[model samples]
Target: MRVRNVRLIDGVSAQAVQDAVLECGDDGRITYAGPAARAPEPRPGVRTIDGQGGTLLPGLFDCHTHLGVPSDRSLVEAALLTDPVLGVLQTTERMKRTLDAGVTSARDLGGLPAGFRDAVAAGLVPGPRLQTSVGVLSHTGGHADGTLPGGKSLDLDYCEIADDVPGVRKAARRMLRAGADLVKICTSGGISSAHDDPDDQDLLDEEIAAVVDEARRHRGRPVAAHAQGRAGVLAAIRGGVRSVEHGFGIDDEGCDLLGERGAFLVPTLSTVFQPLDPRKTTPWRYQKKLRWNERAKENIAAAIARGVDIAAGTDAGISPHGGNLSELSYLVELGMSPMAAIRAATSASARLLGVEDTLGTLRAGYAADLVLCAGDPLRDIGLLSAPEQIVLVAQQGVVRKLTLPERSGSCQT
Candidate 1:
């Protein structure tokens, strides 16, 4: 397949290459991505996509997502009532929506069974490439704990309730044994949970360390900590987590620690900015979200200013899944150039997932995962959030979605 007459964002450069051509081989790797003048001639019978002077860039990555879980539903309701098979089907559909939104890859912090990763890899379904944590580790009454007031534990499929050091270690190992690509732990409270406030810290420091240690022992898999409070953020960093998810309460000191420790921050700006309706869940939940709404924005901006790597994540289950690209606009609002915001969702996220060499860039030899937008996102980052502006979506050289019916062409030998 060949894509021509496009402005290309290589996922690493600060500027776009005008009048570029991208050629993809059948092996699902890019053969060439360069200026049209230097591009090789199209092979016989090549499927050509005329971008019509649109923008072509690396397919985006959402560093944090929960595939099946709906943001509008209460976490407890979504966790407890859904049938296992139906849940998988629902997740499958959500994945397709995510792919249609132009995200080629994602890292699921929790709420997705790891088998789906294999399913997508085997081409049993159409979705973004997924690296799943399988389940989240939390202490009793922690954010992931869905214990009802009636004394019944939700026992959610994607949450493991483990307390103390040994229990956390065991849970981490269990997830690793179950094919988790990374370990996710709740180090702080969250907005959606009924029992804990966002300012409340959950797991013990030793417990956090144990989970991280176990993940390292398992082929050096990275650990993502669900940290939202100042104490929680610092503890996660001190415990050696690879990335801090929803770091809403990180202060200057925590930012310094993150920089020194070389940890990435997934701000989940969409979740932070999402409006809270007291009628949707509970009043306390709404209050919790309101409390950190502005503070998270400021703290994350500080982290960005500290030069700590910021990877784009929507916290999708807490927001809408297909709206993943909306996070880029938030990042731009928080002081990143449009190009840098794109990098956070592209190359930066690829590096975090340890797939930098194969994906996340429009370059020769890289996986042919690409998105064609109707306009230059640098001038208006909001273009990415508009589904109508996403002209085409290709993952691993397979065109999944294309809106430009008039521009698609087939060239003869």
Candidate 2:
């Protein structure tokens, strides 16, 4: 299949090439990318598409997501305890929504089991190409543990709670044994956990080191630390965690450490401005807690200045799925150039997740996962949020969603 006359944002910079052509094969690799005039003649019976000179980019990626779980407390608890069938169904629907929004790939930070991952890989569901971390590992009463007050018992099957270095090691091995592709550790308290303070560190330095070491044993797949405060961010960096999840109160020293260590920072900017409803299960306490410590703007600026690789992540279950592109806009507002923001969500994000060799860019021999928009995202990042502006979404060279019809064209081999 050949796509012609499209504005190309090749996942590197904001500069869009006018009158570009992209060719993809059934194996999903991009076969060509260059000026339309120089494109090879299409073979007989080859599918042809005219992009109308719209913006064509490598598909967007969300570095952090929770599949089949709501941010609401009761629903999360119920889902964890319920049968796997419902969870799979919920994941399928959420994945479709994510694809509809032009996100071709996502990393499931938490809340998905190995079965769900297998189902998605087997083509049983319509969704993003997923890299999943089975439930998170946390200390008792820590951020990922899901412990509540009033003696209410939250299911523990999804999360492994550890209190020491040995415990952390054991838990990491358990998750890997259960088919985890990556490990999630709560180094700090978080907004949703009912009993912990978001500003406080939860895991000890040794415990964090143990988790990182275990992740390394699995060929360096990387560890995602749910860190909020300065101390937590520093601890995770020092302990060799690959990425810091929230980094709400990251300071200059923390930023320096992360930069020196080459750790990526995933600032889920959508959380800072998420619409809150006090009547929900989390209530005003969680909302107020988030509002007080939301330092995404300041921390992001610091990280950017310090040369820390910034990746786009939305914490989708908390903010809302399918609006992941809003993170790019927020990154631009926080001082990243529009091109830098786009790269962070695409190439940079895939690199941080250790999938760069196969995904992220739009070069020949790379996956044909791509998106076509109506305007130049380099000059206007806001074009990402306007759903009506997205014209087409393709994953693995297959047209998943198309808002425009194919153009008329014919060419010989």
Candidate 3:
């Protein structure tokens, strides 16, 4: 299929082409993408379509999401009570909402199993191209442990309790064996979890290193650390993890260390301004968020200024699934330029997932995942939040949503 008459944001750079043509092969890979006049010739009888002067962009990627499985107990009970069958129906539905929201690719931090990713890959599910961490590893009373202070532990599907280097290593291996694309380790306490200080260091340096080493050994799936506080951020960086998630307490020293180590940071700003349920938030979590919100943004601004790489992550399951794209606007409000925020959501995020070579850009040899918006995102980044503004969404060359009328025409070559 040849798509013409659109301004293309290739995802490689900030510039958009006024006259562009994108050709997708039967194998769902982009064959040619360039200016209309510079496009390669299409085969005979190949169908061509006018994009109606829309803005074509590489489909956005959401780096951190739970895919609607609910990390907390209240959300889990609600899901079970509301659905008659396994959460499969609800899970797929939420994922489709993500795709419908113009996100074609996403990484699931937890709250999903290996079967889900396989289903999406095998065409058994209608959702984004997904990479998942089957479960999260945390210390016994750490962020994801689901244990109240000095109390019995609650069994949860999304978390595995691991206290030491060996325990964490075992948990990491289990997730890898379960087909996790990356390993997730809780290096510190978090806001959403029960009975733990968000600023307290949870994992030892050796334990962090163990997870990273174990994951990197098996196909080099980089370990991601959930660190919202100072000591944890420093440990993650020093331990050589690929990216730090949340990073709500990263400081100047931490920022310099991140740049020096070439590690990336995925900051979920949406959670700060709009938490899972502001009204239901515990005083502890509320105070924690309030304390770190401004500091996190300041660290983010510092990260941006210091050229420390940053990616877009919404902590989606905490918010709404389809609301992923709203994160780009938050990044912009936090001091990123509109184009910079878009890149962070797209190509830059693909880099975080280590798929930038093929998935992120709209160029030859890349996956045919693209979104065509009615307006140029470069001019108005907030337009992405409006479903009406996104005229079409294509995942791997398959059109998922198309509000634009199909225009049948011969190649205008």
Candidate number achieving the greatest TM-score relative to the actual structure: 1
Q: In model 3, what is the error at residue 215, expressed in angstroms?
A: 1.0
Q: What's the lDDT for residue 60 in model 2? A: 89
TM values, all candidates: 0.96, 0.93, 0.94
Q: Show the lowest summed lDDT stretch of 10 residues, model 3.
A: 71-80
Off by over 4 Å in 3: 70-73, 76-84, 148-153, 275-278
Give the per-residue lDDT of model 3 (tens digit) for 1-413: 77888999888776889889998998889999989899888756666767888889899988899885653446536444656355777788888888888989899898788787889889998788899988888887788876554575556666888888788888888888888888988888887777677688988999998998999899888888999989999999999998899988888898889889888899888787675455776677677777777888887777777667888888887766787888888888877888788888889999888899888899999999999888777778888988678778988888888887664447574
Per-residue lDDT of model 2, residues 1-413, tens digit only: 77887888888744667789898987888998767777777756667777776888898899998866755445545555667677667677878888888888888887777776677678877788888888798888887765557666566577788898888899999888888888899888877677776678988999998888888989776889999877788888999998999887788898888889988899888887676666664564666555654465677677777777888899988878777798888888878888898899999999987889878888888899999888788879999877667788888888888888774445622
- Pitting candidate 1 against candidate 3, the one with the higher TM-score is 1
Number of clashes recorded per candidate: 0, 0, 0
The TM-score between candidate 3 and the true structure equals 0.94
Q: List the residue pairs that clash in candidate 3.
A: none
lDDT of 1 by residue, 1-413 (tens): 89988999999988899999999999989999989989887877778888989999899999999996877677676777777788778889899999999899999988788888999999999999999998998888998898876789887777899888888888898899899999999889987787887778889888988888899988999999999989888899999999999999998888888888988899999987777667776777777777788899898887787778889999998899898999999999988989999999999999989999999999999999999999899999999998778989998898999988533346511
